[model samples]
Target: MEKFTRLTSVAAPLAEADVDTDIIFPARFLLLLDKAGLGKHLFHERRHRRDGGMTDFVLNTPPFNEARILVADANFGSGSSREQAVWALADFGIRCVIAPSFGEIFFSNCFKNGVLPIVITGEAHANVMAAARTGQPFTVDLEAQTVLLPNGPALSFDIDPWRKRALLLGLDEIGGILADDAEDISAFEARHRVDNPWLFLDDGRMEQLLSQGDGK
Candidate 1:
């Protein structure tokens, strides 16, 4: 996962509510666990018509096609709690998504996958979307608690300190846990074998394993 200190780029407006995970990445494309090729499948159903032509989706536009930041409306990720929604968005080059609200499960999934789900006020969101639609680039400064819009004043927003740290360091729940006590893990494993001899059925098995490689 890549560190996400700050992101400055053109933000495309998706301007829709209750945009669920299934619409973000249709179930048909979930065949592959690896998210690398999922970008092409992002909004798979909506982007293409029954006649096999491009639809009127916001992402189909040229300016929004290469957008890195997405400005969307309330209840951004509402329906199913599929992790693939975050994967598809991140893989599609959308690093951050600004919305007034987000589905609980989808919000958590975003952080775990290195996508910053920014919750902003409705008024501020409108301002950002207007700028984005006009082809202006904006800067989201996580450290400064501000979003700078092109040719306009900066917009202030709030973000939880803990979430900010996770995004900045690119540390997911598992990554944070492991980084917090890597040394303690080694010590605990050593003590576990000694305290519960029967747990390690083979005698000296644990010690031999420890001696064969670096403790880490």
Candidate 2:
């Protein structure tokens, strides 16, 4: 995973609520085993027309096409659990998603996949949505936990400290565990091996077991 310390780039506004995982990345494309080129499949249904042409969707238009931040309404990523939704966003170069709320699963998946899903409300969220409409640059400072809008005002958002640390250090969940608890994990494995010696048998032990098949 890549570090998401900060981003200053175009933001696209998608004011719709309950956008859902399917809308973000169609299920049919879920068959894709590779993460590469998933960007072209992001919002596949919305970006394509019935005849397989490009629609006038916000993401297909100028400036928005290169968006690094996505400003959306409440419940931005709802529906079934699909980590691919976050994958699509990341592949599309969107580092952050600003929404009033997000699906519980999607929210967690974002952090694991190097995408920041921020929750904001009240006037601040309204201001963000308004700023996104302009297709101008907005700066998101992960270390500062603030978003500097196009004009001037900066808004702060909250994130779990551990998740924030992982994002800053470019560590996924397993990577975080190894980085933080490698010693503890090693100690546990050592104890387990001593307690269950048969589970870690050497070549000599394996040969003995194989030869003992005569006693079966």
Candidate 3:
């Protein structure tokens, strides 16, 4: 996992509403197990022609091709839960996404994958989208919970404190658990081993037990 503290870069504007997971990663590519190299397939259909050539999609062009932020329309990332959608965005160097609303699962997945998904509505959303269209650098700071638009003042966004911490530390759920309870876990293991030494069998103890069982 990668930590997402702040991102200041040109944002690719995806004005389409309800851009679903299936469209982001595509069902056909679901068979791909590895998350690496998923950037090539992001928005596959939209970025490709019927003849398998490149289209003039925003991401296929200059500046946007190297975009690290995305400003999308309402209901972005809606549809079936496919974590690869977030993976694709992350693999493509998108560390932050701004939208009016997001799919419940997709929004959750973003935090797990080290991508900051920000929700802004009304004039703020419109302004961000407009700035993104101009291919100007937009800054998203997880620490401050703010999005610095190209022209206007930074707009505030809300996020769960826990999720914000996880992203800041580049921790997944299991990593978070380990980090939050490392001392407790170590102390518990020491106590458990003393209480149940049989459960802590080493190679020699296991071999001795096996030999005794065989003799019996």
**For every candidate, C-alpha RMSD to the true structure in Å:** 5.5, 2.2, 1.5
Model 2 misses residue 171 by how many Å? 1.3
Judging by lDDT against the true structure, name the best candidate.
2
**Per-residue CA lDDT of candidate 3, range 1-216, in tens?**
988888889999989899999989999999998999998889999999999799999999989999998889989999999999999999999888899999999999998898899999999899998998888787888899989886779899999998999999999988999999999999999999999999989999899999999995
Candidate ranking under lDDT, highest first, comes to: 2, 3, 1
Residue-level error in angstroms, candidate 1, position 108: 0.7
Q: In candidate 2, where is summed lDDT lowest over 10 consecutive residues?
A: 207-216
TM-score of each: 0.86, 0.91, 0.95
Q: Which ten residues in a row have the lowest lDDT in candidate 1?
A: 207-216
Candidate 2 residue lDDT tens string, 1-216: 999898998899999999999999999989997888898999998999889899999989998988999999999889989889989899999999999999999999999999999999988999999899988888999999999997867899999999999999999999999999999999999999999998999999899998898785
Query: Where is model 1 more than 4 Å wrong at Cα?
Result: 197-216
In model 2, which residue pairs have backbone atoms overlapping below 3 Å?
Answer: none
In order of TM-score, best first, we have: 3, 2, 1
Q: What overall lDDT, based on C-alpha atoms, would model 3 receive against the true structure? A: 0.92
lDDT of 1 by residue, 125-162 (tens): 88887888987778888878788988668877777777
